[model samples]
Target: MCAMKYGLLFFVTLMATNLVSEADGDLMSMIDYRYFRCVMKREWKCPDSEINFFMYTPEHPRKHFIDPRYPKLLHDFGWDPMRKNVLIIHGFNGTYSKSPMTFIRDAYLSRKDYNVFMVDWSELTRFPCYLSALSNMKKAAQCTAQLYSAITQAGALAKMITCVGHSLGAHICGMISNHLTEKQYKIVGLDPGRPLVSAYGSRQFRLGRDDAHVVHVLHTNAGFLGESGLVGHADFCFNGGQKQPGCKGHIMRIARCSHFMSSCYFAASVRRSRRLVGIPCDTSCPKERGYWGINPQRRAVVLGDDVPDGSRGMFCISFENTEDCPFD
Candidate 1:
């Protein structure tokens, strides 16, 4: 009787294994082969120590670490409830100390007396681990949501806060809403990561129009490293949304350079609002010869920080001179 029981247990375990394999096969058919290879292979749950928040004020340009568990530490670290808050999240392989997203932080600080928070989850989403990084985004977003909650509870108005993110960081900003009772006011998604995300990620896992009152997406390297077409309430396709003129290299190298340029362009716009203007386009970046023929009747909209909250549509803009474009 004991032998029979052991045999039955072994058979049950084999069936369970087969069931998991069948489910995995179905998922693989839905996503890219590269993503299938790494999908949930090494899922990660980031600890509070691995995710960190830093606050920067105009008076104190230096960043001060703030723990969400200790909400009072926000005031101790020079967080001002009266001032508008800007939360900047970095992409894969990025840290609060240094990254292209820092340009946006610097721009906000220089332009106005605002409280800036940098969300760093670099240890969980380090380079060469894109798959694991994708898996860890939800945990990172959950931890950051706690920081956002603490800020609002400490008297910072939700309407006065804006979340700015680049690449995978963009999706993290959106996912924060999943943990909140109310939605965010504004979200600037700079070149939201494409790859496996754009193809397989659902709205809950990616940046969407409903994530915030105003979701502005700027595409600098669309269809390659960045998500193409409209992914937000307002989508701006700079230089056709595929490649920036100033970025010079082979295809992949240029795409990387273009991806980084989104932050640079946003920084420039914060400093000089309404300068980088765009006009309504049919979801496609217009060629140089065809750009002039676009309907002049369409009202032009400003790109970046000052974009009106109610704005919606796909817009395209090109630099008459490459020198005007910002490059990192």
Candidate 2:
């Protein structure tokens, strides 16, 4: 009788301990990723080893799109219907639950007034740090078809399509960059991984002379590209990349940081910041005013002589304030 009692107590203690020590993957509350990015602020802090552990695991992402409520908000705020699109891709370790595209879709849905998208071809996925070689790049590039497909699904008339990629996600973004747009697309690479540019080669990461006018890489955690790459941005801005406060850097938040989520922080901020408008100019008019998203309240857009006077179309001005700015 005593032995049976001891066994029962032991089993109860075991269950209690298991309940108290939850694994990172425990499905309880939805992770507020934006609230816990790699920066070290009061809201987002984690041990270094956890950051590393988080990157190696693969989370199959559920496919997602803009939430329905977004359009209503855009209409409420008086946004233009004819505007461009922006696609945000997450890096290796940054996926939502099981779906790599979850937060990406969340980003699009975050600002429903504008055309936004998430790009994923998990079938061709490679290890996060493996961008040091092109050995698997050929297989990884197969995702271009999906890339083209998603762009078509978003809108064929979109004047410009910008690709924002981080870390390995940037490499994945680079893989399809060649075909992500109809004419030329814009690309924003944030702390692009070291192996990414080299493993994929420069051809994999490019912004055409006529390709949407610009490409930028925020070099905070850039292990390879020098400080100049950060400086070279026409609108180059730093995230503090993997190390910004509020969001823990990968090196520090290794447990929570993944190749996918690291760059995603920067991508999310940039993706939601632009102000989009439409201008109905005659086809004969040059594609003068490039599409941009301005808060129309907190921020301003000052076009210069250098502002892509490139041959494009005229833009109609209509304010589409980014709904509840993601960075906020």
Candidate 3:
């Protein structure tokens, strides 16, 4: 059994490394050597030590590490109970500092309206350890839930908070509800990881429509790195949700770019709400121009941060070219 376990580990590592090679060049440049050391050291069992909560507010733009164990520290760090809170979680092979997830963090900070808290569990979800990262997700979620409780105990309302996550982090956002007495008010899942998650993950372990009061999912690489079909109350598929027009090069590279684009699109939405709009379409992207016109009766739905809480069903948005889409 031990030999089989090690062999499986070797296989997963090899496969993940090959997969990472196909990612966008920009994503490749962001890989921190520390993640390699963490993966090599087999730091998969995410204890309390592996998870951290860093709070950022307009008053204190710099990150202030807040321990979930000390809920009162929130007050000490200039956390304003009056402002809405947003918890941002990064995905596999991601660090709070370098990953594309930082786009969303900065967008929220620029608005100066939210008390932003970024959950950094990079040590637990390092690269080339996809299986281990998946294993660590529940512990990470449980730890994040403590932070949620800490924020609430510090006088923030649960209804005024939003949980935003990318890829595996998206599922972590959903799983956070498992440890809480009540569900979160909102959750925006950016291209929730597909791999083992879509095929094997249970509802409790994956992002689902019922995970939050309003769950919005942006699919930029569906059927590949991102989850396909209707996975949330509001699902937006950009450029057919397969290959983003803005991405060029090999198919895998495009897929990676597309996967990362989910966060980019979302961040843009936060900065300019209601700017990106989608029309009601089938589960997939509309085939022709006539298809888009066929649904004149259905009102076009806004995508991204300003998506109406009541919006439901699959929506599709097509861009004439890369310039038309906000994929920065």
Cα-based lDDT at residue 311, candidate 1: 80
Superior by lDDT: candidate 1 or candidate 2: 1
Q: Write model 3 residue lDDT over 135-169, tens digit each, in one string.
A: 78888898899889988998999888999999899
Q: What is the C-alpha local distance difference test score of candidate 3?
A: 0.78
**What is the TM-score of candidate 3?**
0.85
Worst 10 residues of 3 by lDDT: 38-47
lDDT of 1 by residue, 1-328 (tens): 9999977754542332222121123323433444323323233332377788889998888989887877777888778878999889988767767646777888889876689999988787654446667778898898899989888978888998989999889999999999899999889998888777865688899999999988999998887778887889888888877778777755555767777888888888886743898887766532344453355666788776567788877888778435444332
Local distance difference test scores for all models:
0.76, 0.36, 0.78
Candidate 3 lDDT at 22 equals 28
* Model 3: residue 273 alpha-carbon error in angstroms: 7.3
Query: Candidate 3: where is the Cα deviation over 4 Å?
Result: 1-13, 20-47, 285-294, 320-328
The prediction achieving the highest TM-score against the true structure is 3
lDDT over C-alpha atoms for residue 179 of model 2: 46
- lDDT at residue 137 of model 3 (Cα atoms): 89
Error of 2 at 327 (Å): 15
Per-residue C-alpha lDDT of model 2 across residues 1-328, encoded as one tens digit per residue: 9999977754543332222111232322322342122222122222211221110001212333332223333223332335455555544434323433444444544554344445443322322212212333333333433434444453444345566555444444455545444443555554455532443356445322333445544444333231212221233222222222343433333322322333444435534443322222322111123433223332222221123433232222333223321210
Give residue 319's lDDT in candidate 2 (0 to 100): 33
Flag the better candidate by TM-score, 1 or 2. Answer: 1
